[model samples]
Target: MEAIANGLILLMLSIGHAELWTSVINRTHALKIHEVYLKRLRHVLELLMVLFPLVLLFAVGLSDPGVLVGGEWSQLPLWWQPILLLCTLGFLGLIYSGVRHQFYRPPRQQTAQESELIHLRERLKQDLIGEGPYHYLAGLPFNEIFSVEFTRKTFQLSRLPEKWEGLTILHLSDLHFSGTLKREYFIELCRIAQEMKPDLIIFAGDLIDRMECLDWLQETLGPMQAPLGRFFILGNHDWNQESLQIRQTLSETGWIDLTAEPVRLQHEGQTLFMAGTEAPWMGKLQDVKLSEDNAADDFLLLVSHTPDNFHWAEREGYDLVLSGHTHGGQVRVPPFGPIFAPSLHGTRYTSGTFFRGSTLLHVSRGVSGIHPLRWFCRPEISLLTLHSADKK
Candidate 1:
């Protein structure tokens, strides 16, 4: 029993070490640096996260006079103390994040909401794309890559202006049309989104991973109909491609380039300011005009590719922010939630409706990603219905 307990402890510490460095790698990916540099840093950290634990295990658990043999704690070398301390600290930090995730609640600023989840796999079993990368993993018994969820959620916010009440926005992001999943998958998801009949449509970045998939747009996002219009911003993946061509092709397909400039809409005598930000990757953030009288009355909506911009959006007095780069960590571990999110905030904004001060952020669990794998996390599209809480 003693030997078993010591072995378990070593395993726990190894996991902690990996998690610690994974947090660092996620934040590093959020920097305004080049992708090549970020990839190099990630590889180094990941190697350390794995190999360091194995070295320590060989030294302390597998050798003579080691803990696994029920050796006295004092038998360890003096130099090992600080390393053990760091391992313990990292384990504790991992526990704290888990606790927070287990107890996480929707922000108090949100008054009420309803969510309906539609499992596409069940509805269109034979119609799914049926082929993609990671066939080894996607073929796993419960892999959720093809189980797209059409999540229709309503948000009742006190800040919603009367004119915008009952307004619906279909939020889509991170399509990553890398051909890992065939074009049919994207076409079907987009068709369902159009069926939702939203007043406005927003694609919050990461449209495609392969330029060859560019032709997939017309049958997918091109025909999407919304009275308010379709707007988009490019994500880091798009930056790695022929971004200028991507932008031009998207514009020609009729989606307005929100990152190019801020858009102001006058509706039912109400003002709405909309803009997009692709910071830390693509374009710069567009500033809302201050010249308009009663600028405060305009309901401000900022579309950011990364939810890490939540703080900046809050400070800028945005009423709502939409984003979708993290893909809800691509996979979620129960109790611990998401373990891998590419954001400065770690997994805090993995996917959800979070309210900070006056700004409400809705992060999408995007449809597909580069890895083409998912466990507990399913591909998601959200139809967000905004309602006024003043009626409450």
Candidate 2:
């Protein structure tokens, strides 16, 4: 009976591994060496599939006291069982390594599809900027609007007044301010923000993507002055040592870094609580200060680099949560939506506004790119308006 169970487990494991391999091949762009890798993967799978049944048979046949464990090992086929077991374990390890290699690790070389995508992006850039092939990529200064009216309940609960209800919250995130992000574009983005006359401005993590470009970003960011106070939070990218240097530069030049912390604001006689969470999803709220005297009354607004804590904010009775990191799946399909949404929730609420009861979760598509291309989803800056209860 034990032998049968072990055999069944092995069979199931074989099937599962095969499925995983199939999925990886289907999703990833094929390379020249992919065929060789595929053959090795298939060989490993076949070995497991073939050995599982044989191992089962051996275990059953050796069930009697004449087997190794039964002290009648001399009469049993001892070598075959040990050999099969060793082979199975080794093959399993190979499969595991393959899966890990394909998903977790970066690709050694760009696939044909990736190369094509780059070319396509270059073409689009040439067309958009009216430049030659090697003119260098310049930032296109464009305004991205993400305006939404608030519910009546939102205004009634918070004393922000009916007239000022439609106040805009300008949001920027994941500004990979390095090779591609030109100095002019940063100033233009800040100018646009100023021109829009936003009631509040929020920098939701990752002010710069590369550390080497910190000086350039700082030069651009220095001239950016908004009417409302600007608040910033640390992103996962910013936590890196290189990014820390950029953060220090920003810190020196009037950019506030809120790490798992919340600050209270009194705008137009309304109390607003803005909190930021430390990223990478440790499931703990950092830097968020809750006032014990009147925790419930504060119109709590939370910012996280990743939208992992949407449920967390909802459960904690937050009014609104702002986040980025999904980048609208960065590359979304028409009906199927984003191909890769980096979250526990997969593609659900990849970008835009989602409601967890009364709590609003706004995931920005982001301002720049790490991969240098977005298929369907364009780079964005979210503009959220706070409406009063009476206005509704």
Candidate 3:
């Protein structure tokens, strides 16, 4: 009985220790460290999990368990035993609570059909920005382990016009084009976008990272064609002195700049109102209010760099809002979700499709970012299909 009790205690302690370590690992920010070092640490931790039980068994067997040769409990003051028992009980309670929470948590309602464009995460092991000796040695080995998934989200809107029910908008954002990412990458992305054959292409923001990459814009993004048109808005990154040149380059490439004012398009016997606001970081957004004349029977769509305008969009009675800035927190951990999101409201509107009353907001993880590393948080191209809820 004493041996059995000791074994049970050891088992509980082992489980608790492993659980505590897992929680710490999931919550800890490891992006600051080099990839090579983090990989080595992870390997060591995995090895320890296997060795821990054996070590515990050996220690427990060799140590005194307050038992006598007569098969009776020792009478000597074992004050520490009660304390150990209490700690074990507390750990057990914590484990139970975690399990219950996981099992009882409500599932998030999904409105998107997610599909992988490239299985690069499984195929490639080199980083996208393969430069410098440090990156080659530390990051390259783990490169391309990150995915860039394309999601098709269909939102059933009661106010959606019947003619626009099948209208597909291919949303792209945060294409942080610099020397780090080659033009070939963008060309490949354009090929994929072309194949998807969206009726409209909307670029939310962050088209270029630096002024030098400005020339590559037309060659890279000019190939992406849509039947209706391709519209673009400026991100905070685009609000520099070179912005005028960037806008000119985009215009020459046959892209419509929707930054100055809202544009109304007549498509398939229905009116579609599309508007874009300047990034809040780049000073105040232009006062493009939706009037009663513009509101009647038309589908209102707004684009912004950040999801900060979700409330504003909701208040303005916009049917849909597309955005990308947070990069889906860049790295997401299972159970804990996104570790860090660059938004005013934090991780509240990080990524994916969200319903704010009748308005649907879709935030993309984006094609690329300034930082090259992405874990469970994959970069994305969002394809949104509008469905009229009333027709269904």
TM-score, one value per model: 0.92, 0.60, 0.69
**Tens digits of per-residue lDDT for model 2, 1-392:** 55455556456444444434433432231222233454576566557656655554456444654232333334546765664455456446445544532343212111111110112233234233222222243332221111111111112224344545566677777765655534555555555545556667778876665566678655565655656577777665565436556657777787666663467777666577777775552225643635575445567778878787788788877877788876766665454446455555555556666666667777777766544455666666655666544434
Q: What is the C-alpha RMSD of each candidate to the true structure, in Å?
A: 2.3, 13.6, 8.8
What clash pairs does model 2 have? 155-389, 165-386, 165-387, 165-388, 260-286, 260-287, 260-288, 261-287, 261-288
Which has the greatest TM-score?
A: 1
Checking candidate 3 for backbone clashes, the offending pairs are 125-143, 126-143, 126-144, 127-143
lDDT (Cα, tens digit) per residue for candidate 3, span 20-91? 444344333212233345457656766765676676555344444432222223442477456446546645
Q: Name the runs in model 3 displaced over 4 angstroms.
A: 1-112, 120-146
Q: Model 1, which residues run further than 4 Å from truth? A: 33-37, 111-136, 286-294
Instruction: Give model 2 RMSD, 1 decimal.
Output: 13.6
Comparison by TM-score, 1 against 3, better one: 1
lDDT winner between 2 and 3, please give it. Answer: 3
Whole-model Cα lDDT of every candidate shown, in order? 0.83, 0.55, 0.69
Worst 10 residues of 3 by lDDT: 26-35
Per-residue lDDT value at 46 in model 2: 57
Which pairs of residues have clashing backbones in candidate 1?
none
Error at 269, model 2, angstroms: 2.3
Q: Write the per-residue lDDT of candidate 1 for residues 1-392, one digit (tens) a residue.
A: 98888888888888878888988988887877776788789899988987987887878887756888668667888888887887878888788888988898877655555555556667666645434445456556777888777877778777678877789999999999877777777787899889999999999999877788999888999999899899999899899888899999999999999888888877778877888888878755545333355466788899999999899889878889999999998878888888889999898899988988889999999988878788888888998888887573
- Cα deviation at 83, candidate 1, in Å, is 1.6
Provide the lowest-lDDT 10-residue window in model 2.
109-118
